[model samples]
Target: MTRYVALGSSMAAGPGIQPRVAGSPRPAGRSARNYAHLVAAALGLDLVDVTYSGATTAHVLTDTQRGAAPQVDALDGSESLVTVTIGGNDVGYVPMLFAAGLPRPVRRIPLLGSKIRSLVNPAERYVALEEVGAALVEVGRTLRQRAPRATVLFVDYLTLLPPAGPASPLSDHDATLGRHLALELERLTAQAAATTGCGLVRAGAASRDHHGWSPDPWTTRFGWPVPRRPAPLHPNAAGMRAVADLVVAAASG
Candidate 1:
């Protein structure tokens, strides 16, 4: 039987209200059923989930917390698969962008434009991306060292905001910024995968068509109320299933 290990942030941790197992402790409202669990089950592999909430690549590679293990320690020579989703929290970039109201068109810029111009210098963004890429490469190399035969898959971040809505005033800018940030992250992840000789899974491309009102079976809109809970930008059970399907296909192939 193949063993699989998944590493990343909250999305990998499955932060949301799930149907609680009778004896299992209920995770917080912010915790949803993430894609890793879904994929592991689909592949019938022994799953080791080492994902943490609010984790960046640096944190995953270094942090030690109860229930949240370091990505490096999860590796074993006998493991057959390793999947990683990381780098969003680095520099607190995503939250800064979103909280700065980049998700909303009007507030995004010149506020976002000015902030982007002022706070994160071009040199800084480049340097940060470089660091993120290097960390991913290290993660890949470490996984390979520990599990020489395992097929490593490195996943990029998803686009949390949907394309501009017709009714929204900031559609064009929102779309542009969202795509810009997502693409940059994708490039960094791709670079890491290339450096490490690991497989790259582009979540943005896979999810491009299904955002906002057109959410795939796996996602819900930002403000929509879910049964027994509410989650903002995370994937729901259906989304996890979709992620699982993609991962299983990749692993099986």
Candidate 2:
């Protein structure tokens, strides 16, 4: 049977959307419903889900929490395929941007601007992107070294802009920043894939039209709800299903 490994952050983890036991930290069940599981099941593959909530690329490379094991560990004696969805939380940029609102021209001022810019600026975001990309490359290289015959697939993040309705307070700016951030993430993903010889899967592009707050068959909310709690900005069940379909298609191809 083919063997597959999935590595990445909460999106990969499936959060509240993926059914789990009462106290289980990780999402329970196979990738059957989750994109990873869906792809693996379709291919009759053995899947090792190394995905964890709140995990960053650096954490995946180095951390040793129960749910968050090292990506390298998941690839030990790999078989046919390896898929990854990382680099979303490297510099804590997304959360920070969501908290700080959009990029206003006033934020360009030196002191306050530095503080806000640190939270909103594209340049600062790019720094985090670079770190994430480099880390992904390292993870890819290690996976290749460990699983020489496995096809390495790096999945990019989906877009989070153009929300659903009229611009709410701070929605327009946040959406704009989200668009730019999504593009930057794609660039980083492409760069890492190029360096690591991993097959690049543009999952983001697949969700572009359906992303944001608009009422679509694919998306649930706009700009992700606040409180950052159980079901915050991550994908809902429908979203996960869409993700699963795209990943299954990518894996089959």
Candidate 3:
């Protein structure tokens, strides 16, 4: 039997996928519909899913949460495949990008406005990029050391917006800033993957046509309604399926 391990944050956890397991721990809101689960099912691989909702590279490498072992602990040299989509939380991209949606009046406050602007300033973005980039590099090194025979594949986050044009729910400015951040993240992830000799699944590009702006979106918009939980900027059921296909292909190849 092929041993497959899935690691990372909410993108791997599938937060809003219905029928969440009872007593499923926070951060690790593991859902059967997550791409990881779907991929495992499609490939007939034994899955050890340790994905959490808000994990950073640190959580995967050393930290533990909600009584779960560190993500790497879920790995052993016997593994045949490992898939992960991490690094976003390390740079605080999700929350900061959402800040773009602050009430119009609140965004007028000088101090707050200045802070938000600084958050996207080139220097700040570069610093964040460098920090997360280094963490991902470390992740690659550690995974190789820990799972010597495993094929490590680092997946990128899905596209949250279109290439051009303002998407609903975000001010044009915010939409532009969000796209910029996503681009930076992809660059960092690709760089790390190349450095580590790991496979890369460009989930962002694969899901580009299904961005929130699309008539048939794979991912949820910032404030789209989701039953029983706050809207997370995560892949919906369709998005999960799309990602699973990509992952399955990579693992099989």
Candidate 3 residue runs with Cα over 4 Å from true position: 107-123, 228-230
Better-scoring candidate (TM-score), 1 or 2: 2
Q: Pick out the ten consecutive residues of candidate 3 with the lowest summed lDDT.
A: 224-233
For residues 113-179, write the lDDT of model 3, one tens digit per residue: 7776666555676587778889998898888888889989999999878789877667777677678
Question: Pairing residues by index, what is the TM-score of model 1?
Answer: 0.77
TM-score to native of every candidate shown:
0.77, 0.79, 0.90
Q: List model 1 lDDT by residue over 1-253, tens digit each.
A: 4888888876566566474323332342223246776777677878777676677776667776455456678776888888888776764445444443434343447666666544334455556666776777777777777778889898776555565543132245444554556677888788888888888877767876665446353444445345654255666666666677777788888
* TM-score winner: 3
Root mean square deviation (Cα) for candidate 1: 4.7
Off by over 4 Å in 2: 21-32, 101-118, 121-123, 163-171, 217-230
What tens digits encode model 2's per-residue C-alpha lDDT throughout 93-182?
A: 456545555346657777877676576655777677667667878877876778788888888765555534433435555656666667
Q: All candidates' lDDT scores?
A: 0.64, 0.66, 0.81
lDDT of 3 at 41: 88
Q: Local error of candidate 3 at 103, Å?
A: 0.7
Ranking by TM-score, best first? Answer: 3, 2, 1
